[model samples]
Target: MSYPRRRIIQTGGALAGATLAGCISVSDDSSDKNTSDDGSGDGKTAAGTAQLWHGRSKGPKKNLVTNVETFGSETNHSVKLSEISELEKKLENAIPAGKGPHLFQWAHDWIGEYQPAGLLSDQKENLSVDIDSTFTKAAAEAVQFNGEVLGLPWAAETVGLVYNKELVDKPPEMVEEMQSIMDEHHDPSNGKYGLSFPIDPYFISGYAQAFGGFYYDEGNDKLGLTNEKTLKGFRFVRDELAKYIPKDHAYDPQAAVFNEGNAPFAINGPWFLGSVRDSGVDVGVAPLPKPKGGTPKPYTTVKIWYFSKKMNQGGKNATAGRKFAEWHTTNTDILSTLAEEHGFIPVHKDLAGSDELPAATKAYSKSVKMGEPIPTHKHMSSVWDPLKSAFKKVVKGDQDAKPAFKQAEKTIKSNWQ
Candidate 1:
């Protein structure tokens, strides 16, 4: 894996699954009376309570809470970290009613919806440190909307090729190479597969992306389901790759084959690291191979700490939130822990290239860096199901790729209306 020479540093926090909405800063919420001025009322940021809401569960959730506790202990600030279920939906409701957290953690894709709705604080003015060069280019792009920085990127998640070293000595460099590997090992009757591939649109995106096709183009705010190149790519997956993949398109069956060491390659995300390790396979991570036309570009999601517009009300809550956000993002030690323990790909420029990172992490980070940030346009939410349905139809041989994509485009437009 290669890295950029000039390293940049910034502070932020990391991972989980959620969307953030509005917030109630100390100044805005009367019930949490932890606000206090430092006696010198010179307009300096005050020390007070910072309430954060997240939807992280499991081990990563515990780590987030523990990190918040550490922030409270060191700063003499009150940090209320609540792990709420259905947090993304609750945020959609809470933010407009002025009932969200001062700071919330979630994926960066929501920047388009929240920022445009005036629910998010434009961190350009409030951020304590410059982050222009802090994170990877893709990570930085994920948090920006209409030229404004909406949040600080903590980490990035994207899918890549995971292979068992015993089956393949080296990763494929091109789609042709991958196809040849598939042809050599594929035997459906024998319960063997060449590749363990999930049939979901998210996983199959690399095929379309490799052929210069995209589900949505954020810059143009246009959908591309029917694009000729994209259709060609989908056809490739259906006609060429699908035959080598397991008949059952579900994740578990595919993963089982790869985990049991029956399959050589699997296109998956960082989440698969533990299971592969537990299966005792000497796994190696690599970027998905290039198609004839272009390199594979998987969709990426950047996890970020968003400062809600309520934070703009400014007081102890905003101040403390900023302090903690900056500290958490920039602290290499904390990021390293998350990277090693949770399999998060740190977005920090320095940490991303650090020698301290595990070999698999370093290799996987290449794919994340190469990935395109998932479109943040509100319309993007409408694209997933239609594309997914189309993919299922193509893979199942019920429809051709071109017509399937054409129908998907129509359905998405109908949804948009």
Candidate 2:
């Protein structure tokens, strides 16, 4: 049978069924008889407008709004789109009051927080598309919570070792080599350092991960801050690397140190690629060197389009929202534009290996593959600050890794709600 052009999303394969509530309903046939394209359906109507909220107001990402408009025009649906600044806070407040949109765009890290609050919808039952084959494994895994797929992955990002080729011949393959380079170049008295790594948890989590530790395990709601493996990472950074890091750990200054050719290596994300190019640095990107303990695995964040509980109620809006999300995420053209124009790493398996991707993207993709998804457990929110505090103390030489991480784990457990 010929398929309706709009129903190509279901062509990814057969839909998986489960005895689960909160999943959107999908019909087997491509007939428009039961489906309404105009998003005007109330609870009882065939279709209603699909409302979406996001945080992209500027930069190349703003093109998402244009895409939404195009989707509306093409599908004959009424779409409501809003650009909100404080998306997480607004979503937390609006969803509970029953005033949230049908869909929201955000990173997969929030799945833990929203899914537990009963704000997100289980999407796998009628997803139709095979997530494992459509997106990168990491991206596909990021959208899952407690075995339920909750969103569609669109883009991927993670930190990597960014080096100035002018200053360094090649990126280090092991932490010992990296340390030697730092020692040879470091001259703290004259305001120079070997590297410009930030001490914050986001940047340092890789080291801990390399050593077989995590700040928190969302699956078991367990904290790993004080684990022996984690302490090894903290101690390694403090004793062997932190002294070579510049005093200013803020992003701008750390970037400046690298851009100005004062540092040979910097740990940063794809967002820093443009600035590096603008600064005329011959940039080289590589996966972080394997630490003595294990391979470095940074935290990766996947940008996702999540179906809200509001959309899961099943109606025109739900159908419209699911259709738009599946189409936007799976459309090779849209994903290609996101990667080519915006420097975003495409999570789609088809585009990721394409030779057409920018060189920087190709390099970063290696690092992204080596990384792990940031935990999506709601309690993860309580882990960041405490870990940062412990990290700061360790880096500043005020406290040893054991006590600092001990305190951090204690605080995290106490604050976990």
Candidate 3:
């Protein structure tokens, strides 16, 4: 029952190199057809042919694509999977030219950019079933832009506290409780930190969520970065960064510290579970700790399959894309198999309580219960940079939380409006 240890595959540089060498090719035959038989009776001609692009660098993407190709053949559809880095550039170029793949796997936030460019379809009409009922409400919210559902969730990821069972006999229920335990047990002499987190934007996003802060206040249409509650959250993390973490470690290396057994706790995702196990660490996953008065919540990001608006308008191909996406995400057998093998949560709620999930994944599922989706606004990506920079300054002791947040609030407000 042992699985292959997952590695990061140091392909960032290689992918860039391949992109520079123009290692992308588009099939010129627009008359070929790829079909799948999912028994939904939605056999429509794939517009000439349907093309799919994915960044299957590691873990779930690699395995999921393999399963899709093997099982999806019965549904009369074909998928062309490629490395993410190369496909990113290919998608950017093809999307503008209205020649992109029928469907693409991307982060939830990308809906903002693609929706404005008219590159994504409205899921309300084309989908065979009710989109909202198929997945978690959070998953549905993440794929929407303004009021339109732009994509169907393929998989979901969220941050959670991964702790070494040997270090923490019982996981603390509150942030203060964890801090007290760390203060008493943390052994700096042995290179063991109580916690580790990167100063990167993604980590900041999760911290904000745990503190019950959101990037934008949709109700008031104002930036939430400078609110008193938000500043409190930033200060909480900064204090922990100073007291419990090593000076050399930054946010990106947070998981590495835990994997190397240099830290007992880290805020990360299921993707790191296999790596930590491979590193010989007995890791236990739990929901991110909440502040003294706040509830534990993680910023959940959904990995979704979005159809290009152009593809949807391309006639028969659009119908096929819709059918393919619906079947792929809604199929219980496919979702259960992928979740069990790939270590990701199934989007379908029915599979949430399935016995097929691993213990670690089941632990993460609790966090998913309290997860908050990334905002589906047009300016969300632009706001994170300033917020992350502000957090880093506070964490590094270069600035106080109040001032750093004020600056970030200004930046976020400007872009948000």
Candidate 4:
């Protein structure tokens, strides 16, 4: 796998909009207060209380809470966990109502929105020295808005090609090789697809990157979905969808088919590793196959904990919250334990190489080394709707790649200004 050099593209329009939104201003509320007596004299209490809201429910939540207690003595601080979907709805109302939690976990994209609303604090200046370095550069960069870090990465994942080991002992490295293998073994009657991937815009954009396509030309404030290279990427996915994947399999339903052994190869992330294992199937993971001359670049997303600037209103828990965030991310014991139980790559550089991670997780960590973090601009949220519609049209064979991309570009550009 090849690693692409980091290209920092600062387009004029986006930055100007962010500046207008007041996301570029740095606040002066950096005072730290020590409270609570967990007996460590550090203000952490064996009975300190902190509330956390996340999207994970039931089994995933229980597993995470168990790991949290194992890594840090929760006897010092108790966590109040909430479902991620519910938190999203409640956070909008809660933050303004002064009912938000001390710490919250959210997607990297939320940083841009929350930071400007005065809901989150700048994490870089507030975090401890030792914990600061534990997070990976890409993970850390995602949570940063206008160059100020806002969150500590709890876990991170990138897209990759997962295959059924029994079907293809030696998976092909190139697209052509994969096509040939599919031609030989693909049996529609057996309900097997050579490959499967999401047709939705956010997920399919990764396929475009794999073929050297980009949605935004951040350098020029222009959309590039209509560029020839990008169209070619779309055409590649469209053609593959027609030739190998089943007609009934839409992007959303593809993963279930892959899990059922209906598809020998699929494009997914580390989150599905457990499901595949539980299905009693031997799975092999590899970096996404490269286009003729282009390498596959999966869209990478990072999960981070953000402290609310508004939460500081409580005045008493602010110091302890900062300390807990620092310890949760930087402590080797904490990160490693999370990595082992959650099956996610730890943000800390030291623990990135841990052998304690499951085999699939180690493979994912290796892949993350080659992945690029998604753009963090607030306008980024606007790109998904049009992109998904365009991809679905192409895959469903309703339109040609050229016309589909042109429509996508028009939609994206309409939102840009």
Candidate 5:
């Protein structure tokens, strides 16, 4: 049957859920029954209003609101877009309470956790095929959970190496090349350095990735940070990379130096594009530096629309949700506007070819293509804080790579408990 759509949000992170909840009550309302495998999708047509939930405000939220309203008017379906704080926790509770929204917006990372919790709806094969053909290769692969397409991708982002075009005619292609650029230009006493990226887990991830490592392996559903390549990446960061970067340069300082034209190169994401532009420095975006055996690839995060279990059950709501997802993702004008106005890149491949793309986005596309989808496994959430701490320790020369890595892995394992 169908639902009456509205928004539900809770403000606290702790208001989440556990497994073993009761089943969703299937409505017995026969008047709205439209179950006939209408090719609209699954053999059921729910009769209620579908709620689209999200936690964003400003541009991203505005895009969703307009799309939701447009979808409703065109199809005569009842869909409401609402904003809620701590949306992830609200979803955790509402799904079990059978008062959940029919759809929601979230990052690619959450798909792993959501799937295990039975919070998402699997797409029809036809829809999955459409997604594959429409979205970027990296983004198309990222939305899947155990071979199932879990969401419709909207925006995609990954870090890139930003360099002053005035200082360097061409960006470096490999780590060694980056080092040479450093060797020739880095001089801390003169208020100049080769690179200005931070030494945290997030920043080092691209370097680690260049060495053939990742935070999690989807195939095995396990952490990969302690692998040989990853360990080498850590050592490289502490040994070779850190020496070029001045000590105590956090993210803000890294951007500041780059913005002030004191830095010839810096590793950053599209989000930093505005700052570079505002600084009035001509900048060029390039892919992360490649390592010896592998190409550099940054960790990519995808923004998407996830269909809830209720909508996947097939019915008017499912049809409406699918319709809305397609409209929001495929409309070229909307996607172009979103990418140009916001820092994130649209997943649509055509946008990459459009002359209308934001300058930063057009330049950053090469880096985005070289990037890997950030892991979505729930276990990955445990790796960040502890690993970043371990990373900082190694950077400071206070710890060895082996023990630091072991401690971080152990801490993550503990977090899994």
Candidate 6:
């Protein structure tokens, strides 16, 4: 079998099950804090404790509780960070009837799936977008669906150039510069090389976008990777860029090369900061250089703090709920704490003024501001595996880039079932 064909056939897997909502009524009690109505009962949390429904545990959970406690006194909304393993199912049943917490945290990609179902409110429905004036344009846009803002953008991450600062004083600003540095500094005999970016779709897709390419057309709802620009990018990576990549490479060895300083540059994201930092290498992080002024827009994943549509009823309780979300989401001190304590990428402006920025937080901010938000379309869930197999084949010289991508496109289109 062909390489991609064999890989695709060998890569059978399952997608996550769809979360379902049921017909559950709201509980009405005068003292049941998170009551179901707009204002019939006291708007306090259940038994005087406000809650934040999250899937996080341990360190993340502790950090959330600390931040919430900092501002919980502002609205008399004593809160706790509760781990709900069945988060989606529980929120689905609770929000409609108004028994859910004032706030919940989830990924921005789920905005499309939940927005149409009325689980969340427009960002401007209970609060003003003007308050979010500090958010990056990409961060602000990530919370929107159709034409309305869905929630407040929170922690985010995107791919960037992670380099050995000892090898390169500054990040290259263009593709030519990167190439020049590689040609001058790369020495295979000494275990020193210029670039160690793996030849994978997840990483290369960013460069493809920078060179004017996309896998799916957002507006047309169709595959968009067959164009000339995309082909140009593929050719560049497979031919010219391939020279910098070692042969027969896989993720483990590729990461080993960069971490060991055999290669100075790796295209990776903030999540890898811990591993890279622990390697004890002097590393520098910055946005991917624009090649010929082309944008190397990385894929960004955003975590949002959403207000429950059922909880914010435009009453005194609702008013307090909004204040709670604002206290947690918009406060400079709270945001800095999340950054310093949890390594979360703060979405607010003027983060530089804060003395608490972690090394990873500083490394991640620029790309998070400039990269593309991961698409929320349900079909996108089927995209990654097929593309991963194809990427390996193209870089190994086992298949041409265009044909590899075409085959993966067919697989994704059919695999969504």
Best by lDDT: 1
For every candidate in turn, the CA RMSD to the true structure comes to: 7.2, 10.3, 6.6, 8.9, 8.2, 7.8
| Residue ranges of candidate 2 with Cα displaced over 4 Å | 1-50, 56-66, 69-81, 123-128, 146-148, 179-193, 218-221, 259-262, 278-282, 313-320, 341-343, 353-357
Model 4 regions more than 4 Å off: 1-46, 57-62, 71-75, 130-132, 248-252, 315-320, 337-343, 353-359
- lDDT of candidate model 2 versus the reference: 0.72
Cα error, residue 327 of model 3, in Å, equals 2.8
- Candidate 4 residue lDDT tens string, 243-328: 78766545445766777877778777665565566677788777666668777665667877788665555333555456566667
The alpha-carbon lDDT assigned to residue 45 of candidate 3 equals: 44
Write down the TM-score of every candidate. Answer: 0.81, 0.77, 0.81, 0.80, 0.70, 0.67
Which residue runs of candidate 3 sit more than 4 Å off their true CA positions?
A: 1-29, 32-49, 86-90, 144-149, 180-190, 209-213, 246-252, 313-320, 341-343, 353-357
Question: Taking the tens digit of each residue's C-alpha lDDT, what string does model 5 give over 249-338?
Answer: 566667677889888898877656655776788887777777677776677678788878766556555666666777788888888876
Better of 1 and 6 by lDDT: 1
> lDDT tens string, model 1, 253-325?
8878998988889988776766677779888888888878677778877888998876766666677777888
At residue 365, give the lDDT of candidate 3: 79
lDDT of 4 at 160: 67
Candidate 4 residue 93 Cα shift, in angstroms, is 3.4
Q: Please give the lDDT score at residue 279 for candidate 3.
A: 76
Report the lDDT of model 6 for residue 268: 71
lDDT tens readout by residue for model 3, 164-238 = 887888887788888887786578887777786555556555556555666675456567787777777677667
Give per-residue CA lDDT, model 6, range 47-143, as digits (tens): 2344467655234555665666666556554554555655666777788777776667776766766777677776576564453576866667778
RMSD of 5: 8.2
Q: Give residue 386's error in model 3 in angstroms.
A: 0.6
